[model samples]
Target: MTESPVLMSVDDRGIATATLNRPALGNAYNGEMLDALIEGIPRLAADPAIRGLVIRGAGKHFQAGADIHWLSAAAAAPPEQAFASSLQTTRAMQLLNEFPKPSFAVIHGACFGGGTGIACCVDVALATTQASFGITEVRVGVAPTPISTHMVHAMGLRHARRYAITGERFGPEEAMRIGLVHEVHAPEAVEARLEEIVAAMLLSSPAAIAVTKTSLLESNGLALSAHQVTQLTNESWMVRAGKEGKEGLAAFREKRKPAWA
Candidate 1:
């Protein structure tokens, strides 16, 4: 039997962990993974026994972004399916960004595209010193619209504009400097640090934490509306099915510069 794309568990202490499980693909997301997150986050959120959530990726890399082959296939899919694909991506990010409980991301290895988006949405992001970060959707000619809002919220507009457009890879320190991550530690110490943080989170009032988080996002206009998500999803799917998206994916697979480059 095939293993699930996402593995989720809650410990006796009521701390939940969601692991992106496609190690063979560097945890690059596909529809199954996105749907798992779309379904799982809310279930966990509604559980009174669950105090907080932690996001992580299994194996050598955290998440390398969407699987390119999947992107190519989605681009060729029927319009409704393609549109829904983009919607899944957009909705998953929005759910995490607005999750009711305190949430944390423990990042290591490669973190790109949607991975960076996950980092952006979490209340706390802890990365290993050796982790690499990038908002690289543009490299494949697909707009990073799904992640754009969170990127701007996590890092400032100036920083998000540069990285999302350029698709440059930066190290953990640079990630911290840009406000994408809260702390960077040696790989061996990162898990320890996360345990410390989660313990601290558990000590706080869960209801108060939820209230404060909601207020902060609403006051700053970080709360996303359904129409906004639809607009983003439309832009994302339109580009994936366009000429530039086709050429870009081809160039990447062929290991060559795109025509525009």
Candidate 2:
């Protein structure tokens, strides 16, 4: 039997951890991974015993983003399916970003593309000194509509525009400097720091945390409407179905510069 692409557990302290489990692929997301996240996050959130969430990647990497072959296939799917694929990506980020409980990410290794999105959505993010980050969707010829708002919210417009468009890989310090992550430490110390943060979070009231997060997002206009979600999903699906997306995915798979480049 195939192993699950995502694994989740909650501790006695009500701290939930979601492990992205596609280690051979750097925990890159495919349809199954996305589906797992879409299902798992809410289930954890609804559990009264669950006080907070921590996201981690199994094996060597936190997350490397979408599996290119799966993404290429998605770009080739029927229009409705293509749209649904985009929706899955969008919804996963939304659910995590809007999670009532405090959310955190412990990032190491490659945190690229949607991995960066996960870092951005979390209330607090910590990374190992060796971790690397990039917002590289454009490099593969697809726009990052799904994570766009979260990127801006986390890192601000000036930083987001530069990195998201350039697809430059940055180390953990740079990620911290740009506000993508809150702290950077040697791999040995990162987990200890995360535990400290989670412990502090548990001292606070869960209901207060939820209200504060919701009010902050809504007051800042970070809360997305259903129509806005549709716009993001539609734009993502349309672009992935377009010529540039096709060419980009092909070029990435072929290990060459895209035609436009």
lDDT of 2 by residue, 1-261 (tens): 998898888899989889999999999998899999899988988888999998999999999999999889989999999999999999999999999899999999999999999999999999999899999999989999999999999999999999989999999999999899999999999888998998888899989998999999999899889998999999998998899999999999999999999
Score each candidate by Cα lDDT.
0.95, 0.93
Q: Which candidate is the best by lDDT?
A: 1
Off by over 4 Å in 1: none
- Backbone clash pairs for candidate 2 read none
Q: Per-prediction TM-score, please?
A: 0.98, 0.98
Report the poorest 10 consecutive residues by lDDT, candidate 1: 133-142
How well is each residue in 131-152 modelled by candidate 1, as lDDT tens digits? 9999998888999999999999
